[model samples]
Target: MVRTLLALKGALVRGALAQLLAAEDDIDVVGEADTPDELRSALRAERPDVAVVDGDLVTADQLGDLASDRPAGCPDGGPPGRLLVLVQQRRAARLGPVLAQHSRRIGFLSHDVAPGRIVEGVRQLADGRVVLDPDLVVAALAVADSPLTPREREVLDVAAEGHPVRDIAERLVLSAGTVRNHLSRIMAKTGARTRLEAVRIARESGWI
Candidate 1:
């Protein structure tokens, strides 16, 4: 059967993948989108068998949105199609939690993978199969045993935005000293020499 596809537009690499997939006799490139709004619009208008999305379209906080939009199951659980995100290894940890939960219909590959791999991934997604890069999976599992708590993660997330401890305290309704204590513990847990390093670790691990 001929499969329809929509690629969320971003890096030039995605364009190459689109052209490669379009060359396949069994696949048709139906649309391309540059933003989330455009992607949604194309989804409604094209009704393709699969959507090739950029990792930039997904945020750490949108885990619920991805899950709600496409629950964790096979072809019958949620929408009619699936999603294939182009995530780099650097972003794998941040993208892990969501990936772990929604591995059924949602798939991902490294951004720098070969065109043939991308074509194969698209075909798999069109066939209602899940495709996750092995390296991405390994990176995801490496951070699975995170040592930070939700409150600590929130603190680090605020710190990551270049906020001062006092400002983070005010935002979280905690005292400045309490925030410092949290940061101290966070540093210990993450083995980070400084608050900034802790924040970086948390951000990379999707802890925040």
Candidate 2:
């Protein structure tokens, strides 16, 4: 039996992902698509065993289509192709629920996941098992209590690195006062009394 994968990626990531999936003996990288509409149509036509989607499409509609789409040929009644998202560890919290609702068969991995791990994930997904980064799962479980926004998380992450407000401002290209504002909001959201306390809260809560 010939197995296939439809790789969905942005222009910057398209070539490399295709090259990686095409090299596998059990896997044939069937096609590629950049947009959700194109991807839906392509998957319906080819019915690949898996689709490796990019990490960046976070909207509900995008995730919904990625999870289940009723293209004319591949109606809504059957089991959909397994969905594996290549995402950064930090974005797991944001992407978790959407992935979960789509199917427990879903998994997330860092963009830096080894090529072998990527191949393994695709195969596991095809076999009806979940494949996820251990660290990403841990991070997701840890961040369950955090309601932190992404910008605040970015600020807290920088602060965790021991960068003072001024340095963080320079590195992030935000003004010192703007950085302080973000810190203040971070503290308020986390209920921390000071910067160190905020960093400690974030670290302990795994919001970073």
Candidate 3:
């Protein structure tokens, strides 16, 4: 049997999906989680063959951590199992980095896909295959190529939250001067006359 875990935000959705997948003779619903922490705990406890996660419930960084060979909470430091993320097309760009890092082991599907598709996706992922929705593929590709370096992106991400240079520095543990320098580079790369404009451009372009 293919052991599966469901990690969506809604209790009703989780229960419904569990019932759907459990109806398959070859599939078993091993566990369910409604939050990132619960997902981690369930992953460590069940060590399932596949995990179906809602993209809205976890950030890209959290997904990256879970996608690592030895994910957080895994006592034996073993693989955390394959992931099939249910994400909206608009939010797909945020997954670029993690998808690039764990291409083969992770798959993406539209959040609103038919229930049968999700069930089939779990089987495919368990068999070591990658499944990607065409619309999400296009959405991921449509994200503008980011000119800013990773550090600049980090600075801009904090800046996007309306944080000042000093706050950004403190949050990122960088010197204030360094943060200012990063901001300057970000503005130049984005060709924006002001920091707010830069943040707007970066956000609209899905660079941050």
Candidate 4:
């Protein structure tokens, strides 16, 4: 049986990817959206067998926060239609929350992977199977035991943007001393000697 697919926007790369997938015998490209709002509309309207998305379409800073708030099931516990994601290496680390929430139906692929490999991932998702890039999985697993709390992550996220202690404190409504304390703990947890190093570690490990 032929499977229908809905693709979310990326750059020229995703257009090329659509062409590649459309050429597949078992897959039919059903819809494409250039924004998250449009994607939501297409998802409801098309209800394709598989939804292909580019990672940047989402603006959530931490999937862990979102996943924790919602049930660890499909929204409304509906049919387990698959979601295939194409993400950059750095952003791939953020997928741990999604993995925990939707284990077997979601797939992740590096944007730089070969078209043949990406088509294989799409086919796997369409067949009701899960697929994740090996290196991205390893990165997710490595950061699974993160020591920082959500508040700490927020503090570090501000710090990551080159903000000063006073500025981070003001943004989070905490005092400068409290912000410094959080940074100190973050450094200890990540084993970084300085705040900048800590931010680097957190980003690389997908903690932020």
Candidate 5:
């Protein structure tokens, strides 16, 4: 049997999917989680063969952490099981961080896909196959390359939320002058005359 864990944010959706997967003769619903903490706990305790996660509930960084913290005795020192992340097509860029790093054991599928597709995806993942939604692939490809460095992107992400230099610096643990310099470079890289415009450009291009 394919042991599966559901980790979507919506309780109704999670329950519905759990029921759907449980009906499959070859699949078993091992655990369900609605939050990152619960999901982490479920992963460690259940060690399901496949984990169906909602990208919004768990960030890519947190996914990386879970992958690295796989239960001891994982074959070849790799993650204990496969992960199938369900994300909206427009939000595909949010997965860029972990896509390349965990491509082998992680799959991305559009959340709007038919329930049957999700079931098939779990089976495929359990068999060590990659499943990617075409729309998500196109959306990921459409994101423009970001020119800003990691620190610049960090500043821009904060700026995108309308935070001023002082607030951004305080939140990032940097001085106001350093924040100003980062903003200046961000503007130069994105060719925006104002920080707000730079934020718009970065967001439109999915840099943040």
Candidate 6:
């Protein structure tokens, strides 16, 4: 079984995750703490296999303190797993550099992820890897209808080619539904009803 540590705010959020993880045969909720202090204590004592830390737990020096050492397995014997941050929203831009700086040590997830997805993330993070839910990733990239990034522009360009979401998704290595969803968002941003119209407007406005 994978031993886990949960560091989140809000009684409700903690309760929900606790119940869900408790039911999993493969997961063991070794510790639960509310703030940075309590969380630090729990971490030191438990040395959990994976740490699902909410962004609210700490930041800057406090956050750095918690992350002072790499993730370690329970009992402090085997190599450490990983520390995954659960944020209220995607802090992609802000975390991009930080994550790069600590590539093998950090990962992120949205606080609203489904229970099953959260468990799955625990398994992955405990094994040391990056895992961000797709829908949240899309939402993060689509903020500020004001503009789209070059990568988003590329996703939109390939999606608008009438490639049929499935084929386009295959070509882009994105889920079919994700491709369609991106097209819908692109349409909304450009104030166009159809894919072609959206592409034309986006191109003219230099959004792509």
The TM-score values for the models, in the order shown, are: 0.66, 0.64, 0.72, 0.66, 0.75, 0.57
- Residue 50 accuracy (lDDT) in model 1: 75
RMSD of 1: 6.4
- C-alpha lDDT score of every prediction, in listed order: 0.71, 0.71, 0.83, 0.69, 0.81, 0.66
* Model 1 misplaced regions, further than 4 Å: 1-11, 60-64, 70-78, 148-196, 199-208
lDDT of 3 at 56: 72
Name the lDDT value of residue 116 in candidate 3: 97
- Let me know the TM-score candidate 1 reaches against the reference structure: 0.66
Give the per-residue lDDT of model 3 (tens digit) for 21-137: 999999999999988889888887888899999987776667887877465565676666998999977667666777778877889999999999999999999999888898887
Clashing pairs in 6: 71-80
lDDT leader: 3
lDDT of 6 by residue, 1-208 (tens): 8888888888898888888998999989988888777877787778887778886455523454455564345455444446777765523333333444554655677777667878888888777767765544544344345365434555665555566778766655668788777777777767888888877776555444
* Angstrom error at residue 207, model 2: 4.3
Top TM-score: which candidate number? 5
Tens digits of per-residue lDDT, candidate 4, 25-99, equal 888888787675676666656666777777656433322232223222447744635677777766554556676
Residue 49 in model 5: lDDT: 91
Q: Is candidate 2 or candidate 6 better by TM-score?
A: 2
Better of 3 and 5 by TM-score: 5
Measured with C-alpha atoms, the lDDT of residue 89 in candidate 2 is 75
Cand. 6 TM to true fold: 0.57
In model 2, how large is the Cα lDDT of residue 152? 74
- Local distance difference test, candidate 4: 0.69
Alpha carbon deviation, residue 24, candidate 5 (Å): 0.8
Residue 26 in model 2: lDDT: 80
Per-residue alpha-carbon lDDT of candidate 2 for residues 131-201, written as tens digits (9 for 90 to 100): 77887776666656778865677677778778899987775667999999999899899899988899887
